[model samples]
Target: MIDLAPWAWILLAIAGTVVGLSKTALPGANTVSVAIFAALLPARTSTGALLLLLVVGDLFALLTWRRHAHWPTLLRLAPAVAAGLVLGAVFLAVAGNAVVRPVIGAILLAMVAITLWRRRRTTAAPEGAAHLGTTLGYGALGGFTTMVANAGGPVMSMYFLAMRTPVKVFLGTAAWFFAIVNIVKVPVLAGLGLITVPVLLMDAVLVPMVVIGALFGRWLIPRIHQALFDRIVLILTVLGALYLLIP
Candidate 1:
């Protein structure tokens, strides 16, 4: 395992628990995990390590809410997401950590603004089917942000929120989206040499923490009110994005 101070391990354990909670209940909250791992480990190494734990959390999410997935929405996003993933891989291949963090932060902040504006309009005018352009735009951005920093959670949360998805459907869709995306990232990250044996070793020690968090999140989901859920997502997204922009 990679050498780390006791405090560092404590922080990672907390971050890992957040990962589980993010997967099971809150969507944008995982941005905190992205920030934590990025702060503690080399950016690229952190992405790979955090990703495996995310996959583990994804399985639990799937078990909990897989039936709620909106297949049409997933299908609609597939093409643009694939294109964005390619672009993100290219960007990650060349961008320095300093460049990656601020760029992602800016994107998340912009998405938050857009989501808020859309929510206002949607309130004034009844919601309808998601627009093609919006889907493609968010799809591409989600793919890029996820690949670059595992920070796609806020971006996609904005998208789903704009669409006014119900809470259970939102959790289910996000669960599947990240599960597939993270798995696809495996080969790309490995080729980039981010997934080392030490990373796996470290994650092995932390997987149980993720499970613990997932269980807690599952217990909390039904109790959380819809407005409270949305507020928490927005608050966490903004906080995580600001942290990234801090440099």
Candidate 2:
């Protein structure tokens, strides 16, 4: 098993819960989980481990929102996202922990800005009719951020928001997008030796927490006010980013 202090384990459990919640209700909230894992573990190891937990969450999301996805938008994004993934893999190969951590922090911060800007602006395009340029830009950036730090939630959330996707469609589209991307990442991370026996062992322990969060998120979704919930997530994400950036 990958050894960790007691406190680290506690934090990881919490992060796993966040992962599930993000998958079910809030798309961008996993930025907090990414920061937590990165802070507690080796940056690369954290990425690999967290990817598994996110995959578990993705499964739940796929079940919950499977019928609601916007396939055309997904098709539009595929090429750019693939290109960005290649670029991201190259960067991960060369970057050290010190380099990766701050880069992730910066990406989180930039994603926050994008999300905030998206919230302020209203798009004229109808659903599933977003401009090609907008689709490609967000798709590429989402792929890169997700590959590097498992931090694509905010980027893609911004894209969906800009497209004025209905809540269910947004969640469904994000669910499908990450499910595909995270699975693709498994082999790449394994080739890099980031997904080891220990990482798998660790994820097995944390999987239950993700389940709990997903259930809770499902229950809370209808009752919660999204705007308020998003504000809270954004604040926590900023704090998490600042932590990684500082050290």
TM-score of each: 0.86, 0.95
Across 1-247, the per-residue lDDT of candidate 1 in tens digits comes to: 9999999999899999988987887665676677678767876677789889999999999999899999888899999999999998998789877887677677667656766776676555326677889889989988988888787876687778778889789878988998999899989988988899999999999999999999999898778785766777678668867877886
- lDDT by residue (tens digit), candidate 2, 1-247: 9999999999999999999999888777788898899888888888999999999999999999999999988998999999888888888899998999888888888988988877667564356567889888888998899999998887888778778889889878888999999999999988988899999999999999999999999998889898888888889889888988986
Model 2 residue 176 distance off true place after TM-score fit, in angstroms: 1.0
Which candidate gets the maximum TM-score versus the true structure?
A: 2
Stretches of model 2 off by over 4 angstroms after superposition = 123-128
In model 2, which range of ten residues has the least summed lDDT? Answer: 119-128
